[model samples]
Target: MTVRGPNLRLEGSTFGPRKISAWREAVAPFWDVEIRKEDSSEFRGRSDVYHLGNAIIGLTAASELRNERSRSLVARMGVDHVAAQIRLEGHATVEIAGREVPMAPGDISLLDLAQPLSLRSSGYRAMTVIIPRALFPEAGTRLGAAHGTVLRGATPYGMLVNNHLRSLAAHVPHFTPAEARAAGQATAILISGAAGLGVESAAERPLQRAPVFLAIRSHIDAEIASADLSVEQICRRFGVSRSGLYRLFAPLGGVAEYIRRRRLARACRDLVEGGDRAARISEIAYRYGYGSPAGFTTAFRAEFGLSPADVKAGARPDGASAVRRAPTDLPGGGWDDFYEWVLTLDA
Candidate 1:
């Protein structure tokens, strides 16, 4: 099959007994999956996957599959993504973080990839969205206890989210890169709101810091090119106190560190995938507000353990290089933009 644009479709009947192995390999990048079958020959399964810029959505149907995340597997994989499963047909149950959740048609439940999860399903079909943990900082507290919280599709928010996912799936192929990014942002915002993370409108008078933090973070991202970007400017712009800003960013290692890290990350992406062969390293550095090329190179080396030139060189398949280039075929703005969108969910 000619795979294009991060999309994939797989069927188990094509592989016979090796079907289990095929399934494991297909999802190994995202999850550690296992299955139990009374007779291996009778096993049947199919999966359709769509990569939605920041997240991956898959529609899967299988005959009696079980996923048991072992301690050894968890230690080896270090998985850091979360999967939100929306049941479309049949039934399934998930056990995670000392909580058990059951699902019927039109019901959704969340599973944290970091924790151990045991799922059992029989003749099941579902839509699963796999999202990075960093994309939902506002839902951090709730996500800690999100394992067993089931959202019924009959509710208003549930209906909205479910319908949106269906529509997104139907129209994913037609979306431009920019539209995909916007849809991904909308997905995160809707999930945050559904999880009660204060993603409602500002007119609703949300007193939580999540919304305010999102706004302030959006402002910072927009103004990152400005050399004068500072905590005081952020405070004045957002009407937040210096102390409040510090407290909000304390967990992220302070506001300045966050900005620096974001800048370096963007520079790294540009060096590898910016598609401007003649663009000088110094120009990219200055674009992100670095005072000097030397300073930018030093910081980039410290963060990525390689020089900017090494990173750029790694993208080409020549001789051995200091670093291996990871895949950069993602639509939209990649990880940096995804993080910005996550922080600005309410925006």
Candidate 2:
């Protein structure tokens, strides 16, 4: 199988007002791009976008500019999707409903297309994944209110998502149709989990415990290295009753199950990457709070369907080849494809 991508490509590399006009034409569907008259001479921009039938991913970079989706524009185009972005090289401020959200490099943010927002940025590069609202109906009310929410890249959840989005963008081309669809669904689920960090909408009033729920997850992730990490300690630290904690984690298989999965997940990464130091199997187990090598091995294989030694030897649990890239005969979608991809995504 050959790898192919970048279904839609847009770039303006020349000096002139018309070049800027062309750039705006490319971005007109999703956002209105604005650049000062004189600054047009120095303007440069480019975006390569891909479609996976279930999601749209884009890699974009442009000179300093302002982008907006007015309330009128929101009504004109009824695209209901959520865009999750990771800033790669520059910073910006997103203004939504009069509130300003400052974005920095490595930070991830969510934007609900149904809502209007304006973003002003210095020349920047970014990677974005756009998912249809239909897939996340569970978070609809919460997500509609999550516009302009930011997840700091320094946080545990943020780092995991940050790395996954980047890796997913690069690996999309090699994905088979089935693999791409599965990945798209998995990406949507992963993002909904992270959406817990998003701002809750007062109008929805559905996420009463969202903040506390997010805090507990963060605390668990930070303390995963300690074998003694337990529900009793968590309750004391967060000042929540044991039943409250259980209720918060019920959707994720309870707190203890969450912690166990997290520990094994971290250990699996260590085995696969081998990091700066190739730790022994027993050491990896102990480092992740596993009591014995045998126990860790059994748990890891049960969760991932692969043994620790298999992972160390470079066997991917997902069955995708590690380094597979070749030119493919993929459709080179013209400008119209961008509009079609976002507007009729589920089709």
Candidate 3:
């Protein structure tokens, strides 16, 4: 059955025996999932997913699942999202990069979507946060090698993040679009913190540069509305060399491109989903640090392939039109419906 707000809740009973294949197809966008049972029998599962503006949060309960690296699923899927899986019940093991990490209830681990892995879970329940790689540029290398690295959920940071995820999953439906967007940003920050990439004192600094990069990103998000926000300013604030800053943001198409893309994304959300319908295009552009309305319009059209006016006039951008037009009438059931619901959350 459907839940209120922008969510998709599904149960394996809806599709009965087909749940096995449905599960496979549902995750095909992110992984080539397979169900493995001791005996050849039907599989059953359930999941609830919340479409935060920039991240996808899911609470899932399922029977056993198995993925072997020999299957070469990573090559087949070419996934680009990272899954932070937090266990709520049962146990699971993930083998990645020749290391095996097992999770008990309350433990969490990060899985690199692009890497080959073998994961097996018993009858299990979990909360998963799937984040786009572009959002966490600092964590790129760590995440790439984070296959079996487990974060102890009993730790203070892990507990805080776990509770936050639980609360976000429960309250996401009631959040206004702006709140959802804010929550998505908060989610990224929390995940980074949980992974030991938060701002650190000199004595606590790790060898990796992830913490520094995370701090830089947090600052950029905070000052995005300022016209003077620039790489030079970031360098001054972070005490990083221009070359070092450029190297950090290289994967994200360089720092300036990242800032422009983020600002435009927020502008698009404001144009289509903001509560203040009376807000003008120029006002929206100015709010995101665009100095000129013409420049904003040109950049907006180029990035989204639609004029800001078109979006403000209720013309949805490309694939987004379907969700805005019919949020409730998504076709199919089980995993297919879940997959469609997930796609609507894309920015």
Candidate 4:
């Protein structure tokens, strides 16, 4: 649902300089504050606040001055509350519910508004997601495991979630009402998944796990130009055992075959639309991970019944004679429509 809230602002010397003050005022509607120090000198300064979803998800990032403080105060907070904060730039030390938590880039902290908490923020930028506690049955108990948690590249789920957040930050605005609702539900599922709650429905477990696989696939696609884009390399980079990685790809053939097919498909499109007539077949083959041109030609021919040279030569006819290899079109087509297809996949 489209969330509605008051039009609010924060102003005054509470944010240090006039420039920073203006920014603080703009964001004050969503964050309560107690600024400790205001000097240009860098030292521990403290700020106290809680974030609503608007300030948490809508803003790309918020800049804040460092502060040093100690206090525990929260009132009327309920079970249906969760706050997700990720450091976008700069560092912040967060202390929540009596625990010391250090935060850095790609790290996510789940704040429980029901309990007393404090945050020690240095010069920093961050994104936060506040979820209602009522939405999660095991909210309080599970939140302890997620509080002040660090989500870095070290963990597969962490990387996947971070990547999802990055993607969402860029596309959240384009989401329609239905898409937004779905996206919100997906967000809750992801949080639960990360928290080890295993709260997904029977139908959602697969898609919930799809992010990690999707992350790997996207990584492979971007690195196809590299000669060492092998399944082994992917396993090593993502910390998945060879067997485990294979299991993740079993539905789409084997990992090695999947990479080959993807590369060949991309090469097909490039050969047809890239307008590089003089592009050497051997060069194109090697560029797409084929060590030998002959092997590439064989695979290419097998995939589309046309050799690389024939395809590049435009020997494939344009109409009914030639196969117009493409996926099924949606009722309403484009990216959002394509996402419908994506959502339908077991992934």
Candidate 5:
């Protein structure tokens, strides 16, 4: 028997404008996809998504695609997974540290989902595996060091990972559910091992990472509703220097800003989707770590351009209206499940 959850497929050519709309909805959780104007009217692509227990793997082929993910969106979405991709065919450039680094066929790139990412590619096929950052606690340092860097397929470890990914794409779809789950765990463990392995000395500088960075971020998320979530508390709990912690989160607009953005974003979602329970703005503010309702109101308005009341009162699309993608199944696929999976894939 063959199933598509661990082996689903999407052919964008089958739908009209709805195809593009549905694709946007699927990617909205992470990227702000910008299809070239020329390709917008008639977008074409194919996606084979796999569920690897601890990972969501995607093999995508597209025509002239550019995806822009900003720091603001990063804060709003707060999906901190590690996205590792290998270019199979065609050319793509991923912007890192203000530089557009190109990926040729057979190259690997590691990206941090918490940071900003902008990728542009034309007529390309690549496989991307996204896993939660918390999955590999032991190799946080190595993974941190790997962020924003590309590994040439020519390198020893790079070649191994590249081939391993290709094999996974070829065989994972046929595995039974139990087999897939075990594969997912193996994928995480193997990737963690690879993240720890050093590349040949002359190839690239040794990868380095702040040991406590991911753990601290996790702690913040776990404690966002608490007033005790101060920068000092984080430093003491993680046993890291204050300056080091600051530097680690500088890309996300500082530790305090990260927390505030996360709170407001959570508050925004709650107001928009919290149902009857969200009728009171004060309750929403208090639920998200705000001491003063007035302060929460000020910050909320500044970030979302509307009061919590506005969202709750249905000024913006919410609840049923927010399900803009596809209520009924579309031709060649069912995107509703895909959208939900993107939001709920913890590993």
Candidate 6:
């Protein structure tokens, strides 16, 4: 069945010191949102603030959002939910199903909201479609399996899914009540097909079996920068035996090593794009669990084939270069469709 509604609108300002906290409290019900501001005040701290809205679709970027409050989401325990995102520009990091999924421009990330999840954007703009557990089709099972998974242009399904989202987002404002319903149905069909559910019912995959690895991975990702973060801590938090944790990483090359690789990857990104007044390599390395510069440098060299310094000196790749586009073309569609879409670009 299709559903239709008028385009939504949301507006909040930082007129007073209390504006940030006011916004945070406002957005808490819709999604877990955070804001980190340079200004330190009673109302707006260095934490997240939420702005309430009835699922919006709009675009934002650059000078328009410099003093902006960062937004973050962590879906607490629940049965299951769906988020269809289309990456219009910039990038996003979403923790799901035990992995850190990155979304770049022109990509799509289908997210399951039932499981605990977190999302962060580095000055990103996109379209997101958030739907209740009941509205989703049977294909949600496979879509769950694909959570925390990054789908880029390399996959046909990924391309098609992204294109469909783009189309839906573009027309969200003009859809008639009847057309809106049809749009929802089409979105579900495409998402189901793109997720490889085929003709088999979504029931083929059970909801009770949400990916346990996601919780494990999410914890690890958050602690990656912490020198004290460890697999043992992960084990304790999830109540999984050490051996179970070891097995989880056996396919990738063991837990400790995996964390190292992931951390180094993050450090590489930071160094290259960190710009002026960026943290030093030593600091980056230490932050990512490296004890010494020598150790961190060795790993960085091996993986990226370039010193962190060299990468920082090099310019951002031409294609990945970020430019502020009109809010209309911002990935994931405009704010009107923001909460309903999942962004999975690879930037």
Most TM-score-accurate candidate: 5
lDDT of 1 by residue, 9-122 (tens): 677336347876676655543445656556466677788765655666678888777766543333223334566778888887766534466777887776655345677787
> Which ranges of candidate 4 are over 4 A from the true structure?
1-31, 40-56, 60-73, 76-79, 137-141, 197-347
Per-residue error (Å), model 4, residue 35 = 3.5
Better of 3 and 5 by TM-score: 5
TM-score of 1: 0.55
The ten-residue window of minimal lDDT in model 6 covers 63-72
Candidate 2 lDDT trough over 10 residues, lowest sum: 319-328
Model 5: which residue pairs collide? Answer: 4-7, 4-8
Tens-digit lDDT string for candidate 5 (1-347): 33344346767446446777767766666677888666776677778887655677899987778887776678877766777789999988887556667788988777777777688897899999887666765644567666666777887777888888898888876776566666666666656766655532111312244556667777888898887888899988887787877778877778889999888877777776666766478887888878778999898878777777777887652111233332222112344455445555564
The full ranking of all candidates by lDDT, starting with the best, is: 2, 5, 3, 1, 4, 6
Lowest summed lDDT window (length 10), candidate 4: 69-78
Error of 4 at 263 (Å): 64
* Alpha-carbon deviation at 25 in model 2, angstroms: 0.6
lDDT of each: 0.61, 0.72, 0.64, 0.51, 0.70, 0.50
Off by over 4 Å in 1: 1-6, 12-15, 137-141, 197-325, 330-347
| Best of the two (3, 4) by TM-score | 3
Top-lDDT candidate index:
2
Candidate 5 regions exceeding 4 Å error are 1-9, 14-18, 137-139, 197-209, 239-241, 289-298, 305-307, 313-334, 337-340
Candidate 3 per-residue C-alpha lDDT over 226-254 given as tens digits, one digit per residue, 9 for 90 to 100:
88799999999999998889776654456
Q: Which candidate model has the greater TM-score, 1 or 2?
A: 2
Count clashing residue pairs in model 4: 14
Q: Which stretches of candidate 6 lie over 4 Å from their true place?
A: 1-6, 12-19, 39-79, 197-347
On residues 13-54, what C-alpha lDDT tens digit does candidate 6 reach at each position? 444346654444433334545544543242222221111121
